[model samples]
Target: MARDRKPVKSKGGRPSREQAAEINGRILSAATTLFLKRGVDGTSLEAIAAAAQIGKPTLYARYPDKSALFAAVIRAQVDAAMPPITGVAETATPAARLRQVGRAVIEGAMKPVPLGLMRLYIAEAPRHGALIREVDRLGRQAALEAIAGALAGAGGADAIDRAHVVAAHFLDMVFVPHQMRALLGDVPDEADPLHPTLDARIETAIAAFKTMHLLPAE
Candidate 1:
């Protein structure tokens, strides 16, 4: 018979706040890696716990189920990829701000890590429609709010509905085509690579948005 194993005692008091934060970070880091590799549905809490070097009870303490854990991961990824916009001066040119915000959005979304997260999110979307919808809602709200503000300023006397329409057009010009190309795969070697460099794409998108919305309206 195997020798009787000694029982491990809990640390008695709960982990210190700092220690708990570190553990949570560890969990998120592990989950990000696995989710990137295997996608949301493919990954399990047991795998996440193993990857984080934590026990099942510990993982359960923080995240009771896969959707809860995934929601946490998705929120983190969404925030990281498309962080909330703040601090533009009230009088700043809306077009200039649109360029700035548009670039940030594209760059964040196109990074290798976030790009992988997006693919994973799409892969898991068929099953988790509501979860994906929530993420989309958050992203759209941030993007549209800023873009619409910019358009509102640019439009001056333009109606709010028209300003919003123009804002949607701006996003379509800047984000849709390039994002779709990237998501689909790669362009032909002979073809332009979706705007040469990231900054160029951003600049071109801003120019396109202006041509489509501003100059035409003038």
Candidate 2:
């Protein structure tokens, strides 16, 4: 008779907080890649789990379903696409600062990741309309806040109320038009010496703000 074998000890235990966070990051990264490549509807949780090297149960535990995972991916993209306002305008003239902020906003929006995410959203909007709209609202709010932060020192305390309104207009004037052109495949490269270049738009926006007295007194 063979000797009785010793009972095997389990090597598994709960993941450390850092390890859990790293796993979550991997899941989101994998999901984003799959969603962008295959479109959200075409991508499934099984695919995501396989890409992430995690079990389906793990993915489901973090995100109840595909929509929830998609929402998380979009939220992360929005956060990345909206640049931080801090230190962007420090030590610059008011007009210069506005231009810097506007440039940052445009560049952030035009980045490959954000553009890919936008394409994904547009393709999947029919089924995820509400989710997409909510994501848009959150991104817009964040952009407005960043623009407002750039306007802080220029605008006196009394101008605070109008800052957000002006910020919205500024975003529309400098960002929305360019972004629309970009989405339509009509956008010229930044290095292109063409009519209505990025700098031209920024200058025009500054002039409009000055004429409307929308910018605070300098």
Candidate 3:
């Protein structure tokens, strides 16, 4: 009887690419909900799997562990929230493109999910130095390059310093201040960080660039 035992077959249907993507999406949504509700340290893999309605084995099959899963969630959050600036080069003028990029940056910063992830990352930065560095290298540095390229296009080959300045100012004006506020829980739910009033900040940045002759007068 033991010798006649049949080979066990794999259970369930094979997951198609679409199905896998759907599962990944569910996992991310569940992880995001838990991360926001309980903070990174407070949340657990079991909870995520439960929230996603998937078994622990399935969750681990998709993501090896919590750190990998957290990184995936952060990467997804950043990618979805931040629109790539590649197309900005197509604009007729540098100032126009810069302004567009600036607006995009502001909008991305103010988005709720990205803001939450940003807060989470900052909170975890001290203990999770490697993860923080990975995020900066993967997300922030890449975005900075795009901004620098746009600035270079606007300011010309001679304006490298100006480009860097503009890039730094752009980040500070749009993200840093609001991010700090988010970290402090000072941002009201209904407050719009991308409101027209925020245009003053953009205008000030533009003016600073203009003072250095990096941009033409509007």
Candidate 4:
């Protein structure tokens, strides 16, 4: 019988790509849980390392400080929540695709983890304005990219040029209002007959956009 060969490790004893990804996921997950439970000011790098079952040196090696780690966490969250450029079906009309994009934005914002982080961010904004802006830029950039992709079928350079303007209007008209209500603890309740659910809000916004000629033609 042939002898079983031992698995070869990466050069210089470094972790493999899969291992590195797993370690990063664990670290982010631990940090997110702890931060949500205790707030960013109350959480420490050492605690995060312990919760992740990794050494402090490893955590420090990846992130020099708590702020750096927090930013990484935010980036991961935003990346997960934001839809990719190819998320919408190409067969759909530009207006219908835009509606899908809007729905994605609202649903992503209302997810448990992102919602928790939003509350924490608002509470910590005064003291951590720079850090907040950094992550806020990450999310806004992703949102704009997704919005622009949805508008790509509208026209030529004009459509691309006006993408930023359209993105701003879309967020202001569809997203910001609902996000404010959510931030203020006004969540949708199916049992409550008066509650304005996200889908209903999206439909209303899409109709309004059509009436205002804001949405592009198929």
Candidate 5:
């Protein structure tokens, strides 16, 4: 007797670029929520996959491991919070650029996810020294370069020193206080309590940087 042939199953439609982006967005959203709720150590790949409603293999395909995913999320948050430095000009004066950069930094730090990630980084520092060092190295390099560029463009030959001081002081004023409060679980119920107001903080930081001789005299 001849055996009956089974019908062939059709392959699923290929995901387009937009579809892929949507998937990535879902994964990132899930990761952000999970990371914030559970901390890095408590979160797992399976949990992320389940939360995102995708298979574990899909998550791995996009990010090889948990650390990579976490890093991507942090970078995304930072990019969103900070404005790009495209319009900065060599003729804008060092103080102007410094103010712009300072504003971006303050805005970036005050973002909810970024702030949460910063807290996580600090808490994990004791055990994950390498991760902390990596983050610091990248962050410091970006800040130093931007500050140095602004100072050099506006402050002439003394730009390097001035940039260093500005970078340090800006971080101290714009980020350190709020960062400490968040780390200590002292963030107020109000939205953006860490930053309070961006314009005010930026103005305050610029003033301080000028007072410290980190910016060219007007």
Candidate 6:
């Protein structure tokens, strides 16, 4: 029998933050291309790893499974399209707040990637309806939260329920028609023709929120 040997060293060390980020970027880029090209069901982890030029372990380490990876991709897609929302002063008027959030929503919905993704969601919804619903809920979450926060601030503590109601109304009023048009390929590729309508809807939503949440009862 041979003498005991030293323990085998680990094959690789942990990657630096920058390396991890770059690997994640590659995985997501590959996943996005495959998912869009083949639909969610047709894409596979192996394909994503191969396309990304990384090992299967690396892909799994970052995302446990396809749904998680799909969600990450979807979230990134929406975040890329959506405008960056920074903090606004608490004392800002409700109209100003509404306008700020409203502009972001409109601009985000107008992005080309969303339009294609919307169409894909609709096409795949029959079989993957629940997943599609989850994606939509997440995609709209930031906008809804921002709107709710502004409404809550203006409406005060007692009006939280009414604030949610106002936020829902604002979303429906501003997004429904324009988003539907975009999804159906009715909107032009170059510009959003709904800009004027968005402005009108913002004022309307603000007025409604004020009356329903902010104003004193007569």
- Which candidate's TM-score is highest? 2
Better lDDT candidate (5, 6): 6
Residue pairs that clash (backbone atoms under 3 angstroms), model 1: none
**Per-prediction backbone clash count:** 0, 0, 0, 0, 0, 0
Candidate 4 local lDDT, 1-218, one digit each (tens): 11212234579677788777777888999999999999988998888988888888778889999988888887788888774555577678766777778787777888888889888887878978987888888887888777876766555787776666667777876687778788888877766644577777677666776676766544
What are the per-residue Cα lDDT tens digits for candidate 1 across 24-77? 887899999998988776888888888887887788899999888888988887
The lowest-lDDT stretch of 10 consecutive residues in candidate 5 is 1-10
* Residue range 1-218, candidate 3, lDDT tens digits: 01111223335646666667777898899999899889989999888988887778778888998889988998787677767676765545667777787777667767777777887888888877897778766766656666767767755567766666677777776556655665576643435544324566677677877877767776
For model 3, the run of ten residues with the poorest summed lDDT: 1-10
RMSD of every prediction: 5.7, 6.4, 6.7, 5.7, 7.6, 7.3
How much is 96 displaced in model 2, in angstroms? 1.2
> What ranking of all candidate models by lDDT puts the best one first?
2, 4, 3, 6, 1, 5
TM-score of 5: 0.66
Better of 2 and 3 by TM-score: 2
lDDT of 2 by residue, 1-218 (tens): 11212223335756666677777888899999998888887898898888888777778889999989999999988998887765664567667777778788888998887988887888889999999999989988888887777766666776655667678888887778777777777766656544267788788778888888877455
Ten residues in sequence with the least summed lDDT for candidate 2: 1-10
TM-score against truth, every candidate: 0.72, 0.85, 0.75, 0.82, 0.66, 0.70
User: Which candidate, 2 or 6, has the higher TM-score?
Assistant: 2
How big is the positional error of residue 3 in model 6, measured in Å on the Cα after superposition?
38
Q: What is the lDDT of residue 218 in candidate 2?
A: 59
Q: Of the candidates shown, which would achieve the greatest lDDT relative to the real structure?
A: 2
Candidate 4 residue-wise lDDT at 146: 77
lDDT of 5 by residue, 1-218 (tens): 11212223335655666667777888899898998999988999889888887787778889999988987786665445454555677777776877777666655666677777777777878877886777767765665665556556655556566677777777777656655665576644445645455455667777766777666578
